[model samples]
Target: MSLKIKKDLKKIRKYIDKIDIQLLNLISQRARCAKKVAKIKISKDPKTKFYSPDREAQVLRNIIRNNKGPLSNEEISRLFREIMSACLALEFPIKVAYMGPVGTFTQKAVIKHFGKSVISIPVKDVFNTIENKKYNYGVVPLENSTEGIVNNTLDSFIYSKLKICGEVILPIHQNLMIGKKNINKNIEKIYSHQQSFAQCRNWLNNNYPIAKRILVSSNAEASKIVKTESKSAAIAGDIAASYYSLKIIAKNIEDRINNYTRFLILSDKDVGPTGDDKTLLMLSIKNKIGSFYLLIEPFYRYKIEILRIINRPAPETNGVWNYIFFIEIKGHRKSKLLEKILKEVDMRGAEIKILGSYPEQLIRENKSNEE
Candidate 1:
């Protein structure tokens, strides 16, 4: 408006434009370096994996630690992640498969970890897709803070040879949405994924008590159905609402305010440790007195922090109620202490299977708490 203000704005714009050129030059240099690295890897081994989860995790962690910014660490990390993602694409276009029709939480996790530059394929069956080598990586929901572990993921882990390469913790916010035609009409039916239904059970009971709830394969699917249906609403995330052009009737309908869903990045290659790592293992012990105790005693003896342990009914063999234990510990499987503990458990006559070690994503204030 004023001459002085106009002059000051022009000066600021000039500096910003100069900084933009510098940024462009730096990023281009980085991309060239990434391409060179890829060439070297290919020359060394034709089958080398271009994307390294361990290296990426370490780089992100280092970025966060060194960040002294006006922008939050998260914001800075996200900017760097996209830059890295683009550079990696220059190296080799990475393809990832996720449980999706798109707009699902698993897709969101894939994007969050790999960035939008990756080629993320929507697949009805993520496990099979990855196992068949259709995609280099796959993502699936592992557990939720409110609903606990996803049984399907556990079952897949029991049989699938794919390894857990990484993890992403996404804060879930369920919204009640409806199509344009149904916005004014009374919602007679609600659609959502089963886990979403469980997450927002109390909220739905209080707000839409008489509405008939329908379960679908995914929240995205529910949104897709509700987009054309009158007198119907869908419980889904913001992404689904945007994708389907649905209007939100209610936001954050989940009963828990701090709800989070942890998704696992599955791949054929094993990820090396990043010091702060979590290891998952499956164990089958004899169905006898103190068998469980013997299996768990090594963890306590070796001072390993047991993050979680879930017991599932093993296959019914000869009418016996045998159980399998899924245990998550704080240290990586490569650690000597952990190797020693695994040997001890194996020597105790328990069948132990190391699922994988991945960089720890979710940090709890109190490790004992259920989050």
Candidate 2:
């Protein structure tokens, strides 16, 4: 209300307006530069791929390294991701396929990793769309920290020819959504994916003890069901709530505060390694007592760090009780040391298969879109 205060505010506003104009000009210049790069690349090779995971990771890492804080590293990275995504659209439209039906978390992952620029094709089976060349890439869940591996996705990899080019770990947030018909009434029943129900069982027990439970194919499906059923509530995330136009009665109801799901980016093109990379292996060892130890011995000898190890029962149709070991190790398989160790493992009568060697994602660094 003071004249001096009003004068100071006017001066600040003038400076901000000037800076905003300068920023617009700089961003336009960057986009023009991107266009030139794309033109030159296509001229050299007609089949030049637009998405380079390794290069993108390098760029983000470099930005973080050079960042001097006004905005956090993640804030800068997200802004740059949007910038790149826009520039990429100028080159060509990026098409991504995901396991979905409109409002699933996989779609959220698609938007999270690619920004809101790509053409998202949501289908029941992501692989089918990818195989049919309906999209440039596919996104599928690999594993969950709380519920474990997505067997369907892993099984698809068993026979599919797709390569894993990138990885993202998205935190899962379960929310309670109610429809307009019963906006303020207590929910009589609940619907959600089985995993979601399990993840939020404690919260649900405490809040809606008498509500009946109905399992659905996905959290998205639960959201859709709640849209039509007034007495029913859904446990899904932001995407579902927004798509279905539901109100969130509760947020972050998952049992674990740090639940995360790792999703793999599937492409026909193989990606080169980033310095910080992870190689995934699915191998069936010989049915012998010392086979397990012998398979992992090479890692110790080479001083290679093993990130994770998971065992699953192989199909029983072969008339043998076989086990498949899914091992994840730091560094790419292309490294000389890893190559030598893999060769030694083969010599030790262990068959090894490389699922992928991709840049390891810096998890929980970026704020999650969902629980």
Candidate 3:
């Protein structure tokens, strides 16, 4: 029986080795193909796009649809995402800018979307890094499931010309982490971002209501502070915890179980279409009795599906309770339906600006990450 078990184990190991060799050869071949694409891109057009969001979306969707394995569809898609990222990097490295202190959730989203091979530039201001022109793209948090939309990111869209090309939904799992300190250490203060504090309010109240809670710009910043302060703890995600070598005293302490944050990928180029796209529009109609109805009536007529509607103060619109509507609707801006909708909106003296058309992301578990 022992001999039989040993023989079987040796046979399985041989098979695994063979499979690894085949995978390596296939990856090398794919890299060669990517090199050919690189040569073609630089042959004439310096403005040629090395990355295509629409194409990548279509590929991942197809991967999910055709996947037949023990692994979940999400797992398969993630593996392919990294494969595509690596292949594309062979052609040209994708430089991405994200609002960060290195270990923020925004940085995780960037890695999840673009993979580890791309150059990730961390900056305090999302505008500065993206506007620098050195980075190929930018990633910023748009909204959170627990909290509402990130107003700063939305406001940035009002003036920034960067187009939203793709999106990533990160499943947030907040942890109570301690750096170089024992978990049993006297906890006097808790450090966390304002949003994270809100998300974990219930848990914090229940666990350490008496502890002084200090709000910081980002959870990453909180994590950094906790590294120096022995009597402090930080509410942060896995990235920060891992980066600072922090031990998690408590896991998934978010008040909401399904905490998720949606991030936007901004780029200079436009994606054609991926069948499933959402266009963002900001509009201000003429202040009148029926202006609001008239402004949105065309969407109903065109059978457009409005996903979300956010109203921001229109300072330009005088003191008539006038507001600007930020709308996310289904379909591309260039589509016939949208073109018709825009014409109707323009005729009504509505100041409408199409922020961008991007691939709509569905619910995804960013918590379950694998190489």
Candidate 4:
């Protein structure tokens, strides 16, 4: 508003513009160097083993150690992730598939973990995505804080050949949405995917007991139904609301304030540690006494922390007599303890499959009072 303020603002704008230009130049130079390196590596090795975790980790450490800026370490890490992802794309594009019809929670989770630049292919079912190799990587929801485990997703892993390459936990915020034109009425019907409905069961039962609840294939599909039907409201996430241009009638309808969903990243190739890691495995033992206990005792003996275990009927056998056990543990296959456990399991002659080991999603501690 004043002459001095206006002059100061103009100076700041010029400085910011200069910084932007420097960043652009830096990124362009990096891209060109990466291209040359890729060409040389391809020609020399001919194996096309482009992904190097050690190299990536060194890059991140160098950036963090030398950082002297207003930007925090986390912000710098994210920026480099995008920059490196772009460089990797120049060498070869990464393919990712997730459960969907766009606006579904799985799509949001994939974007959160991989950023917006990834090639995200949507599939009808989680199994189909993994079994058919529809994409290089697949994401499937495994469990939720409020809903326990997604049985179908777990069961799919039992039969699928793909291994767990990584995992990400996404905080879920559910909303009661209605189309713009349908905002006036007390909606007679509500539509949502089964999981969505289950998550908000208590809230819906107490608030809208008389309304007819219809199950749909996905939250995005339910949002579409609501947009087409004036008398229907949909339970979905912010993405669905934005996609359908619906009004949020209510927010955070899940029973728990800290509702989150855990997703498994499936791929055929095994991923090693990214510092933090989680390993998944499926084991089948002979139908003899103490066979199951004998299989899992190695983990405990080796001091490995078991995070999850689920039992499913072996698909190969007709009867439920033989079962398969799925285990998620907090260690990498490269670790000495885990390697020992794997060896012990192998020596026992029990059918063991090392699904894969990958980086564990880091969760920021909640500072919100509501949680």
Candidate 5:
């Protein structure tokens, strides 16, 4: 290489080395502080019930409020998540379970919301993860922009005692990826998760009308299948493509540009205010007339925007005769107005379960062409 190119390469190497050293120093400082905190926590609370959502929320809010930097609120939130995760690890590594075999959208949401430093435990099913309590938190897909609601996730709420602690909205970008050796040809089969297939229904019908659409267990699974199967392509995210070493045959193949999947973070304990917040509730009403409207009227009167409301059959009954309504409303449990509304809900309902209050969904500005 020329002398100029060589000097530039050396400068890049020096910059990387500086970053590595900085990271090491940061980690060392964090470790020392974590150790001290752990000791203090142990001495104060001998029972080892040291996890405090209220305290954590306060810390996060303070960080965000006091932040004066190029980093946006979302970036600051993510940074603090990792910091908190590391601190928590000092006391005890938090096990977070999410729906995955790894490289799935659920996993992406979990990492995005919790940060990569968190101990992520992938579970096969939603209920299995929630019922185990082996996980401090569980991330599960609740709804998608195109596919509507995930009934299975909603049903788990009725069976498991786990509460919704937070919410995450991950932008869904489905790509038609195939093995590197498998160039573009007469594609015989298209593989994807049932939900992914549904989301891309219009695109599939229009472009690959003759291709046999196969439903796999997940997007990751579809990618895995396509890696070995010739003349077959899979619909998955960029992460899955990287994992399976697949080439993107077609990019952003979803039916809509703004496709997004909403996920719920479940925990045994409720979350507190982080300044910005959202609350999820599961309400069961008496099968009497106008009971549903009566239950929702309080929220309307309070001027709380109801983001979503999905009906799932009460497991107690065999048929769809009895239904449990899952509702997502604005504001936190700590808000004075929301506190009063909760009381009103209690008086107006047969049963009201406060699923937990968590930080509001982070809205990222999309600059990509497809979006």
Candidate 6:
């Protein structure tokens, strides 16, 4: 409109263009450096792994610590994560497997943790896929804050040799969505995973009280159902809506505002401690009086903070009443104190299996993804 305003706008645009060029050159330089590092590693050892969880966590933590900006630390981390991901791809493209038909929250966690540069494979069974050497890593749901632990995933760990390498905390935002064909039609039926329905029961009751509710295998399945059906809606997350090209009628319809799901990163490689870590142990004690006390006494004596403990029936036990305990503690398995505690538990007649020791990732990232 004004000549002075137009001149100021032109000046800002010119500076932005220059900065963009500089950024491109710097990124190219970084990519070259990553390639050199990969070559050096290969020369030393042919079986060297390119992805290091402990190193990545340390880098992210350092970035967060030194961040001083108008942009939030989470924003900075997300940007750097993608940049690092791209650079790593230059070294070697990594493959990841997740439970999916596509558009599931687990896939979202894969993208959040590994970035889009990775080759993410959606499979019916993530655990078996990784175990069969079809994929380098896997991401599976561990627990939900509102609904509790995923028993199936926990059960898989009972027999699987995979180790937990990392964790992702995703804030789940369930949405009521409709396909393009049913945008203005009367909502006759709704489809969603049972967990999604349970999470959004109150919102559904308030909004679509008379709609017929149907349960599906997953939120992604619900989205797929709504994609082709007329006068139907799906209660799923943003990824499902985006993947299926559905229109979100209601956003964040979960009953609890703070609903979050924790997903575990599974790999064959074990990770070293990153100072702040959590260890998971599966223990089966002898069916005797004070067995539980014996198993837990070590943790108390060591003053180790117990994060969670779940008791399930041990199928392999000779006694009908024998149980398996999954205990998570706030320390690495390699720690001297934890090692001592493990020995004490073993001496107390408990068969202990150290599941994994991984960096705790409770810090929420504000990336705009599905869950």
- Which runs of model 2 end up more than 4 angstroms from their true locations? 366-371
Per-residue CA lDDT of model 2 for 127-152, tens digit only, reads 87787787899999988888998888
Q: List the residue pairs that clash in candidate 6.
A: none
> How well is each residue in 1-371 modelled by candidate 6, as lDDT tens digits?
89999999999999999999999999899889999999999999897889999988898899889989987777788888899899888888989999988999999999989888998889988889989988889999989988988999998888899999999999998998998888576699999998999899888899899999998999999999989889999998899988999999888899998899999999988999999999999999877889899989889887999988998877864546788899999989999999999998898788988889999883685435433
lDDT of 4 by residue, 41-135 (tens): 99998756465543565577678889897977667766887888788788767777888798888987777666666777788776676667656
Worst 10 residues of 3 by lDDT: 362-371
Give per-residue CA lDDT, model 1, range 337-371, as digits (tens). 99999999999999988889999873322211322
Q: How many pairs in model 2 have backbone atoms within 3 A of each other, for residues 3 or more apart or on separate chains, i.e. clashes?
A: 3
List the pairs of residues colliding in candidate 2.
171-371, 172-371, 173-371
Clashes of each: 0, 3, 0, 0, 0, 0
Q: What is the total number of backbone clashes in candidate 6?
A: 0
Per-residue lDDT tens digits for candidate 3, residues 157-190, read 7777778898998888899998886456679999
lDDT of 5 by residue, 42-73 (tens): 89876464455556667767887798989877
lDDT (Cα atoms) of all candidates against the true structure: 0.89, 0.86, 0.86, 0.80, 0.80, 0.89
Residue 48 error, candidate 1, Å: 1.7
TM-score-better candidate, 1 vs 5: 1
| Cα TM-score of candidate 3 | 0.95
Estimate the TM-score of every prediction: 0.94, 0.95, 0.95, 0.86, 0.83, 0.95
**Model 6, C-alpha of 233: deviation from truth (Å):** 0.7
